[model samples]
Target: MGLIVQKYGGTSVGTVERIMRVADRIIEYKNAGNDMVVVVSAMGKSTDVLIEMARQIAPNPSAREMDMLLTTGEQVSIALLAMALQQKGYDAVSLTGWQAGIATESVHGKARIQEVDTARIRSELQRGRIVIVAGFQGISEKGEITTLGRGGSDTTAVALAGSLRADKCEIFTDVSGVYTADPRVVPMAQKLDSISYDEMLELAILGAGVLHPRSVEAAKKYKVKLVVRSSFSQEEGTCVEEAADMETGRVVSGVAHDEDIAKITVVGMPARVGTLSRLFNTLAGAQINVDIIIQSSYDAAVTNISFTVSSDDLVRTLDTLAAYQEALGFDKVEHESGLAKVSIVGAGMITNPGVAAEMFQQLAEQDISIKMVSTSDIKVSCVIPAEQTSLAVRTLHTAFGLDVAEQAVVHGI
Candidate 1:
């Protein structure tokens, strides 16, 4: 009805032909009488290729330079899409993240958006032109280029939608919509018609890959409606919003699995009152996101603390723990990188029992061993062997009755 923000991922605009198709799609939306602001990621594998090129030049390039180099990918995307739209006799313009007024902190490669100055975007919108903004990047207060980390394009789109007060934010991904499990892994995985913001946030943070957690956070905070669909098809996709009414009987909404996880254990720490606090605070100071933490007191005088972090942070986490060994008073620090986290999320799980038991039983039937376990009101995540990730996902997907009968939709409502 009013302004809408649309985002296309790398695969959606991978080539000139794809870019033309995307332009046509945008034109159709414009013809529908709605103002449009589009966000786009780099062409397929272009960002990875750039990273490889940078590593070829320097083994460990500076994060600041990486941001400068990586932002070019999205710029390429915006420029090409704008050119395609113009070639089709449509009024279109391209703007980089900073040109569109995206301001961020000075965190070189992984900056969070601080605020958006919408004057430039609003000005372009008033001229009846489709504005294509580079996604995943912005500028810092010190006039430095900064990139939002992985899946940042989704964050950019959602943030822009909130700032513009857009009617909806459409995320055009490779998948038709959010699924009960990864369809590639579980053939029976069903696409959801709608999901709550909190459920979607949990799935994204747990590695759903359809949307980013930060984007869902912004959507929930600003009450932005989100529609996730495929760029390649016109299939009706999923709507993510606040569930109007909480229903009973459905305990497990979806199963999420992540392979990019590593666990660090600080073993035999002095059983002091503030040992856990000091250990975690030290990791926090390093900006490492710890997930799925586990602690046990093996004896009266000693305790074991284990936590998971991104695989990229595993080395740094181990190094930090080793450096602070004396301060943390831990006898040994061990790290495991060959682990995966498999989780099931459902809002109904808070009031429903036996969900975790069923999940654990299914995994056990599949001969999967759980290494570390973490539970929230709505989620139960377990760390297991990375190799068994797919098996675990499939098992749990079927166990939770998430599979379809004749079609890919779950049986019944």
Candidate 2:
């Protein structure tokens, strides 16, 4: 029998009823003669609640302690799911990240999976037990608990599937499948039947919430077959794999937007070979991820550099820059919140000309001012005001003909 790895997000196993429902689903898969490995996130909003508790205790708690506290959310999920399976008269076993042999780097809040020793998982499966693993967490070489950052459970499942060489890895979430754009923002967004790993990775990194970017990276690296679907329905899901030719079908695969963005500009900086490097190195040391960077030079001697970061990291980023402002010789540091990043992604864009021009033309026509811009072979991202995010998404969705027609249907199997 083939082995299948499935991951349920926080919302899928949010409540007692949902946990029981997930148990039933696992049982059904077992009856189909497949060895099952299930991974699950914490119950709905539990992680958030835990974070709130920590913040209440201390405004800036220790990252090591936070990791210790956050991993418990998935621990509760795994144990309860195991109990539900047993109540249904099925053999089941639950494993935490350490118990399942997931070894990670020592980074407390955002550890990366170093390797997965799957001997325990194999033993449990051989005993005719469904294996449920706590997602989003792992033990470090230092014997400390480390939690992967947000959406890390998705990475956990894909990494497990890769290590086990499972037949398929299914990601079950609240959304039915991957759409051309967020269905909440664009009602006409169509669900894709299938997508290339490159396109899906771009979408994930650009803010498509259906799957995690790290999971997509792992899947692509290991050639793992992935399916994304809704736990709430029986509908067929979107398959992610390598395509014969990425540019063969549609020119634009999807439009993704993130409203959780803030922009920072280092003004009146002397232009030098190491000035840019020094500025960014400081941010990297602070663990701030900079996106969509732009540099403008008014004269040969000085330049203005700007970049975007997640709004959550804005304060830390500013603080980091301020500490080094004198050393870096920057005159002033300015930042603005209430900004958004809008992006269009497709593998076909590599071969298609005018994709950027077309996107810019559409925004210009709508009087939506583009601030900073970044482009890769498959994607182009622009920073704009947060209030105009929905309008930009809708406008681009229609501009690229990504909007679904009335009575349109998604065909999948």
| Per-residue lDDT over 149-199 for candidate 1, one digit per residue giving the tens place of the 0 to 100 score | 988999999999999999999999888899988777787788888888889
| Alpha carbon deviation, residue 373, candidate 2 (Å) | 1.2
How far out, in Å, is residue 73 in model 2?
1.1
Task: State each model's CA lDDT, in order.
Answer: 0.90, 0.92
Q: Model 2, range 358-389, lDDT digits (tens) per residue?
A: 99999999999998889999899999999999
- Which TM-score value belongs to model 1? 0.96
lDDT of model 1, residue 358: 86
Per-residue error (Å), model 1, residue 72 = 0.9
Candidate 2 lDDT at 86 equals: 99
